[model samples]
Every structure is written in C-alpha cells, then in structure tokens.
Target: MRFPFFKQERRVEERPRDFRVISPRIIDILTHLKVQAEKLKRTYHRLLARDKELFEACVRAEQELDRDRATIYANEIAQLRKMSRTILKSQISLEKVIL
Candidate 1:
C-alpha cells in the first residue's frame, strides 16, 4: 500500500567526531579525584597516630566517667551512714529491774 504521502527515504549525513583536548569539567573531576586519592594515601600512612589519638581520647573519657561514678557512690554511702547514725541515736532502751 503506497500512498506517496510522506517523504520516502530522507538522506542523513554522517559526520566524523572532532578530536579535541579534554573538557574542563572532565579535567576538574580528574584533578579532584587525584587530590582525594593523595589524601587517602596520606591518611593510610597515619593510621597508627590516628589510633593512638582515639585511644587517648577514650581513656580520658573513661577516667572522667569513673570519677563521676565514684563521686555518686561516695555521696550515697555518706547519706546511708548518716541515716544509720540517726536511727541508732533515736532508739530507746527500757531499763530492766529484777529483785
């Protein structure tokens, strides 16, 4: 069924890709990745120092927590001792007389 309505077989032109330098966006992305890689490599070499700092920080935090815990325990013990002393003082003993 040929109606000859639409144009038959349009001719398309094939163009060759122009070889040019790298685009600025691509260059910037590559440079950024390169810098990031260098930073990662440097950090990898400093793992021991990083670990030591983390350990020292954890130790300091644990010591502070222990000091706070000790203070709380001491306060509770002092309160209990005061209550015991008060109870002992308030107790009355009846005198016993036997003939």
Candidate 2:
C-alpha cells in the first residue's frame, strides 16, 4: 500500500537532473510527499498497535471476534493512490515576467 507511494517518491527523488535550480514547485512537491509519507508511516504504526491490543484482548477471552471485509482496507488504499495521482498530475507553469 504505502510501498508504491514510497517507490514513486524514490524514483522522483532519484531523477538525473537537479531541479532545485530551476523549479521550486518540484522541491515543494518533494517536501509535501515526505510529510505525507511520514503520516502514512505513523498511521501504520498506530494500526499495528491497534491490532496488538485487539489480539491481547482476544487472547484473554474478553474480545469477540468481529471481522471486516478486506475491501475496507483496499478502498482506503485505492483512495490514497487516487489522491496522489491528482496531486502529481497538477501542473504549475511559470508565468513570464515583464521587464
């Protein structure tokens, strides 16, 4: 899920040219991606903790077994990709400055 996002960010970061000199928008995008990636990382950590808590309760015979369809997570993953697609597809063309 987060793997593809991470991979795309890596590929973009690995570009042969340094756009820092020519495009601030690219830098901004990179920064935004880094922040979002961190957020996803934290979300994973929190979800893991939730799973662990559920497992502990289940082991103690206090938690009932309730399962959700896999599609729930799948849809969330798809939505994330859709958001990234929209973000990346946006263009910021430079305007000519009059002398």
- C-alpha RMSD by candidate, in order: 31.0, 19.4
Model 2 ranges with Cα > 4 A deviation: 1-22, 62-99
Residue 21, model 1: lDDT of 68
Q: Any idea what lDDT model 2 has?
A: 0.49
Shift in Å, residue 26, candidate 2: 0.2
Q: What are the lDDT figures for the candidates, one per model?
A: 0.52, 0.49
lDDT score for residue 9 of model 2:
48
User: Which regions of candidate 1 are displaced past 4 Å?
Assistant: 1-20, 48-99
lDDT of 2 by residue, 1-99 (tens): 567556454444555765447587766776776666556556655655555554554444433333343344445545655554444333211111100
- Tens digits of per-residue lDDT, candidate 1, 1-99, equal 656896687798987766476689877876766665555445544543554554555556557887665555555555545554543333311111100
Measured by TM-score, the strongest candidate is 2
